[model samples]
Target: MNIQLKHGADRLLFGMKESDVKALYGEPDRKYKDEDKNVIYLYNDKKVRLTFYQDEEFRLGYIITANNACKVFDEKVIGEEWSAIMPKLEAKGIRAFEKENFDSVDNYFNEANWVIFQVEFGEVIRIELGATINARDEFDWKF
Candidate 1:
């Protein structure tokens, strides 16, 4: 079992109970049933399969997958707004820069081929999410 905590909070990462998730993030984006009609909640671009079986320690076992996969982008965007929240940037971790105004970063974003930004309490890295492709299939940052 892999356990991940955010900001020292024992927040739910993945592979958690259905009830526990409901208590935390509330209703999911969508709900569905299997061939047997077992209700399950789909959250954060993840599909949590809840199975009600007999002769088992737990009636339900969930298969978790992020529901909006785009949440990574969302998190990065939010982290940008609150750059002060992060301490520094590192490998696989997010950090925030010292600049109070994001205009400079914004300018860099539009002017440069890649946008360099920090992830709060995580890491600092560049991204090219919206990069366009050229005639030769090469990425062009002109936009």
Candidate 2:
């Protein structure tokens, strides 16, 4: 499947209702609620997890993916060389840069767009996409 990052989150877009997610992804491998009562759907087999928040209504808020089986921008991101992926993101007008970490490196593209790729040994291992509001602050607190 081709995953689009323009929708704030991958696969599941922002403002998508709970039912819309079920229709598109079918039943999740596992489902649970967090301490805050936010719903989380886990597709472990696909190495994907989706988190939704409910306030007035339920809507998709975050998407975390570790699998590279799907294509993004027509390129296989996971396990691909960062050198190869950087150009593709830039071609899409998404500026790419990296932050060094002790263990794994974080490559951020379009910071204003909130797209991040966690790299290890020059290969993408995880991708996080969401809105800035949904992201946790430096204090480890969510807004």
Candidate 3:
């Protein structure tokens, strides 16, 4: 699928309702609710996790995936070396920066497109997307 990095899972986007997510991905492998009542949906088979905030009208708040076969804008992201993906990201005008005290890097086209790539031994092991108020605050402070 021609998944855009700006969106969440292939067809999922930020702010989508929980029912919509369920319709698209089926039942989650597991579900959790935090003190704040935010729901976390884990789809182990798909290697993806989604978090929705009840305070935010049950809108999607986060998407994280470790699936190596996942594609972003038709480009294979997982399992690819940073060197191979850097140019593609840059070509899309996405700027990347290494996070302090972390082994991962963050890439963004904008707030809605913010993504984190966790690296270990020079390979991207995980990818995270979506917006959290706290993250936006920190991002604003940094930029």
In model 2, which range of ten residues has the least summed lDDT?
134-143
Query: Which has the higher TM-score value, candidate number 2 or candidate number 3?
Result: 3
Clashes of each: 16, 0, 0
**What does candidate 2 score in Cα RMSD to the true structure?**
5.3
**What lDDT would each prediction earn against the true structure?**
0.34, 0.70, 0.70
lDDT of 3 by residue, 14-116 (tens): 7788798889889999999978899999999889889887877778877888887877768887878867877787798776555533434533223445677
In angstroms, the error of model 1 at 101 is 50
The residue pairs that clash in candidate 3, if any, are none
lDDT of 1: 0.34
lDDT (Cα, 0-100) at 100 in candidate 3? 38
User: Residue by residue across 26-86, what tens digits does model 1's lDDT show?
Assistant: 7778767666555555554333233322222223332332222213322433224334323
lDDT of 1 at 126: 27
TM-score, prediction 2: 0.77
Best-to-worst ranking by TM-score:
3, 2, 1
Report the C-alpha displacement of residue 36, candidate 3, in angstroms: 3.6
Cα lDDT tens digits, model 2, 108-132, are 5456556677778888887877645
